[model samples]
Target chain A: MRIILVGSDKLTYFLGRRFTSKGDYLTIITPEEEAAVDLSRRLKATVIAGDGSDPTVLQEAGAYQADVLLALTDRDQDNLIACQIAQDRYGVPQTVAIVNDPDNKAIFEELGVSVAFSATEIIGSMIEQQTASEEIRNLVPVAGSGVTMTEVVLGPNSPAIGRAIKDLDLQGAVVACVVRRGRVLIAKRRSYLHEADRLLVISEDDQYGQAQKVLTGEGA
Target chain B: MVSNLIGGNSSASKYIVVIGCGRLGSLLAGRLSAEGNSVVVIDQKESAFENLSSEFSGFQIVGDASEMATLKKAKLDKADCLLVVTREDNVNLMVAQIGRIFFETPVVLARVFDPAREAIYREFDIDTISPTQLSADSFMQKLNTHQVSTSAPTEGVA
Candidate 1:
């Protein structure tokens, strides 16, 4: 996937690194030359020094062909404007914006922009998960929201992985997505899971323990 | 000779270097400096110092804290503590990890934006603060206290 990220800050750089490592083409746009230079060097992604809110800059960065455009600038207005330009002018299929101000998240969503409240929702969910259980490795909300989906990579000794999804007996959780050796498999009852395969599960707040037990095979 | 050595050591105050001088970094530096501990701040952006306390009497360097050269320049090995308060949680984590794992600094604290990433930071066994979660809780508290005023008058008032 071709991903264009606006801003060269730490979050943008982190995402750029993650996406680039996954074989996704990434281009980062930053107004500051130092940020662009630093992030470009760190992530080894194409860094364009220009105003992300400008259409000309977006064109130069190949925003039109981008599969996903992330407007992650520090300023909320800049992110919104960038998202608008990417969606409206460039005709990008998927555009996600980071809403620094949680209050403006609704406005961005209303405009049909996928919004990630990094400072609020993302961190809030993680804090909730941390308080819930220690076994949760990394909890990333897919598509940046809803259903509270998380990816859990089973440990080597985990008892649940060898067992089929149905045999794991997940009481209140549903496996939504699974990734085995770069192959994405939608969760199914018949899916015979493996030890190293990454699993994406969605469950209620109360069911987190059961979900963790099923994922980690702690109970088994 | 013993009296001269004791007098010389008593005059030297403990110094701390804070890397990634953002909001939390600046705050910690300011607080520590105010308490008479010598402080030095290092940040990639030179403009970040604008928010720093004027009363803080400390050296400020504009450079990446992750770089070994920068760390050496900041005197990490000699500093009593290294505080990593960059906005990027990863950078802060890396800085803290290096301070603890490499330099074996006595104290290392990092600012972590994602509370979920705390486990990873804990694996490194360094202190961490999640500013984002605190901000969210503050917002939630404000929302709970928010009151809506209706057009209707009170029972005793017109």
Candidate 2:
């Protein structure tokens, strides 16, 4: 496949080296003269020194014929714009970007980019997997922007314990599912919260604080 | 005019938020406030507000526009119109997108140095002013006019 890389980061360099070694058509665009020269020498790919966000620079780098365009620029906007230009103008089959802000991946996806990879999302999920917190566990953020589903275990001394779900002020959050004593329980308004009950709640990003306050009652 | 564009019929002041308190942002905020509109100017650097006119009665916020919390503090969701004039194109684009898409502000505009980067804004139906393109066009037009009027070869230093 004819692949185009729009930045000189480690990921781009690694991909460029691998593609060249395998004899695939590869091109790289970077704004640094020394980095372009070095990449060209080491990776044997056509390297252009200019802002990759510019359509003219991409045109000069033969973006029209690229089968895949990877916008790995450090800035999320640059990456998004570069991928957009490749997809909209050049009609590249595949367009991907590396987003700096995890929240922007959803926006990029909505804008029609094939995919967006965010380091923050990856690292955040990794940390979530590794965390040993007894109250909150495996909080997997969903869709990158607004909502996340997580497991929260209420302690014996918590305020929500023994209270009906309807009584809790969980206006901004949802108690989607609940597990108690190795059996799945129906999560309804009348359902009662018990000590050590594992609740699967989905809440918006900004309302996580309110959801935590409602469930844990620590903000009292 | 701001109230009209913001879908409000009230003759009262409309809310305008300007991100980046640089020269252009400060001037805009000052002018809007002088017009009796409620304005808020935000910048990461507190010193940037020194450029604002003393007569300006708008609120000043010192924080990064890239953060959601900062934008919330600035009440961006309640803004009738938002102007993003940050030096970085990415920050401006992101903030403008949020103002337009998330907050559904009536008017969202930004200053982009790279004319090429304006395509993304155009795709999202956001407005952008490219100072680089505007200045270059004006300068080139003046240069051409001067050249056409001074085509005579100098015979001697008179």
Candidate 3:
């Protein structure tokens, strides 16, 4: 994938490295010259030094040809503007913005921009997994759209625990990954269940409600 | 009976609008309503009011409080005070700025999720509350004051 990352922060650098390691073409745009140098060296990705909110900078960074554009500046307004410009003007296929404030995620979503709440995307999912029941929470992409990833966490007292991953009888959910003690465990048919381990599951919008019940035991 | 119900001439009812109907919004709304003052809530998600009291009798609007349309729906123009308690610092800042600049609301309170962003919100002359920092500070204060008992349990206590 050709990914255009707009930000100079540590998180941007971290994501750049991940994309680079995946052998994906990555381009980074930042306002700081030092960040551009450091990240380019670290991730071996193309780095452009300029304000990401500027259309000329984005065009120079080759945002028009990018498969995914990430606007992850520390400033929410700047990130929103960058994503809007990338999506609306440059016609980027997929534009994601990192929203520091979780509440702003909705507004971004309303504006047709995919938002990744660093806090909620990571911490909330972890908490949800810790609080879910025994049924494995399947991770599924949003229906008719591959934009959003959804998962259900089984509460602690759920009856689904102690059962094998393949035995859950989930209807329309798929288990993508399982996280335990900060380790991402690949989902397998015979993986044994562990309490407080989060099953990274995904389901379409229509299947989310039923998937939540099958995984958490309350929704069913 | 009417005379008994009415307070002194100096004591007037204060209307408050609480944006973002999350835990903080619900609590503030309940508290203000309990004080015999009018309260209004604005939230994007309608499900946020699941835990709120029905008898509270406050106006609830399902929309982004930061937007002028939603704020006007909540009567931001006439509100005596505004509280932005959404989980996002940017939304809170936007709401506070709108309240201050457009509506000229007397008081605007905003919840800053990130401690690092507090100073930027403060620059707008809005009251900012950092739950993460404040909670940590309170915990440190308790530790420094030795309020938490450090004594070990005696044998066979279990």
User: Which candidate number maximizes TM-score?
Assistant: 2
The candidate maximizing DockQ is 2
TM-score (0 to 1) for chain A, all models? 0.58, 0.59, 0.58
TM of chain B vs. native, candidate 1: 0.76
Candidates sorted on DockQ, descending: 2, 3, 1
Per-candidate DockQ vs. reference: 0.01, 0.20, 0.03
Per-residue alpha-carbon lDDT of model 2 for A54-110, expressed as tens digits?
889888989889999999988777887788778878888899998887777887887
Relative to the true structure, how large is the alpha-carbon lDDT of every model? 0.75, 0.84, 0.74
Cα distance off (Å), candidate 2, residue B98: 2.7
Order of candidates by lDDT, top first? 2, 1, 3
lDDT of 1 by residue, A1-220 (tens): 9999997667787888899899999899999988888887788689999888677888999987998898887776567667766776778889888877575576567655765565787789988767544445546544533445666777787777667888876766798888888899987888888877788788765677778876786642
Off by over 4 Å in 1: A1-220, B1-13, B140-158
- In the range A10-126, model 3's lDDT, one tens digit per residue, is 889888888899999999998989878887788878999997867778889888898889988877666766776677667888988887767567766765676556555778788
User: What C-alpha lDDT, on a 0 to 100 scale, does residue A210 get in candidate 3?
Assistant: 70
lDDT of 1 at B51: 70
Task: Kindly indicate the candidate among 1 and 3 with the higher lDDT.
Answer: 1
Native-to-model Cα distance after best TM-score fit, residue A145 in candidate 3, in Å: 44
**Which 10-residue span in candidate 2 chain A carries the lowest summed lDDT?**
A129-138
Error of 3 at B77 (Å): 1.2
